[model samples]
Target: MDKHGAKIVSVFSCKGGVGKTTTVLNLAGIYSLMEKKVLIIDMDLNSGGIAVSLGVDATKSIFNVVDDMSNNRFNTISNYIANYNENIDVLAAPKDPRDAFKIDSKYIDLIISTAIYKYDVILIDTTHILSPITLKVLDKSDSTLFMITNDPVDLKNARSMIAIFEDTEKKNYKVVFNQSKDTGKDYFTLFDIKTIIKHNIDYTIDRSFYIKDIDKYVIDKEILTLNKHIRLIKKGDVTRLTKIAIALLDKKKNNTRSEVA
Candidate 1:
């Protein structure tokens, strides 16, 4: 696809607990701020958290739309996607894990195509472990961000993922290193992890300013608005994240600028 055309990007890895949902939520926020029509779909049906992270309720989910689509009634998709801003929409995951398998490849394709027609960017957050649904997402994605953390197990999984997709259809994959601890100790830097994995690291997010004591948000089904104090302190973090989002969407500009200057 071209620069103006719609694109699907799935954020995945071979392991769990690597801040995948957090990356998706923050990136979606950045894209929304850029005024792009963005739709974030949570495919981690086992236990999705996009709604909880974004401070939204899960009364209606993407599963409802999938069921409607299977029965030839897709109008329900719009009904379930909770709108965060004028440009951002979110399709929450299934409340019941069993409902996830109910959605097959064809249904997922329909969901993806319909989403592309409606939004400029469709961001999918799949289960960390490789599964049939994850494969389907990978096959359909125009690009992907394989997430990893500083942990050795996560890095091992990252290597396995790069090896698995080495011959796959989606070769335009990149790496995102999250939850970096800058404790004045020269522990494994992003470069070290990149070297081990043998893939060019695209993003390295510093671990800081996580929302504390917010577990109740899940049960309350509330939207996770940044607390006013945090909004002020983390303004720089937000700007940095927005820059990453813009760079991802404008890939050629980087190469062209590098050549010219």
Candidate 2:
């Protein structure tokens, strides 16, 4: 699939601990390697891990930006973007849950629109639980990547999320599987996954040990220094994620064409 301009991709999951944050970070890095400018917005307001995943302190967040905007102290989008290497930028989530309620769809559009003008890919990392902010994010995204796992409880939660999206009548979505250990044991098959969730699995990411470094590098903002360490993990999983990202970009293009046609 060919890439497109100003794509909003949300990495989400019905259940927590499904490697949503890891997938977002690695995919953001991979997209950067593809020469696409990427911005990762951490919308998981309660337990914002994107900053921690990248090894940064989550002191300042989207709350600050929204607060500034409300207080007539609005500035450029560059003010909220934290540099994650040359090609990637990050907008951290609020540390306080109370601040999350303050985030509405209108300001989100402003933030996303501002980033879209400057970046090719906008990756939004969302909280696992349902909330107004999360709904706004999903409703606005061009495509949403719903992360799932082999666990039964996770699949059950995924079903709930799918139901909510279905209720909204939004169709731009794909499923991603994570943390498959494959310990030489017979377990849930892809068909089983499809049967349970009733959605096609777009891609599966194998478990990686260097996952912790994902947080370390992002937190410390040591993209260059962590290059060798991250490189040791190979490009397999992230490459797969990149393919899906490109497909999403293409999907949006096709949708636009269909609308025009």
> Model 1: per-residue lDDT, tens digit, 1-261?
234556677788767766677667667766765677888999898799887676666778877887887777767457878876677788988888888778775677777766677787888998876777778787777667787777777788778778766644346666777663322433577778878788788866666535554466445433332234444666666666667777667646322111000
Which sections of candidate 2 miss by over 4 Å? 1-5, 56-59, 96-98, 181-187, 207-233, 251-261
lDDT of 2 by residue, 1-261 (tens): 123357888888888777777667767876777787888899887778777666655577899888888888887878877776788778898878788778765688777766677888788999887676777788778887889888888887787767766665667777887754332322588898888887788777766433543445655655422366556565565556667767877753423210100
Worst 10 residues of 2 by lDDT: 252-261
Task: Count clashing residue pairs per candidate.
Answer: 5, 7
Best TM-score goes to which candidate? 2
TM-score per prediction, in order, is 0.81, 0.82
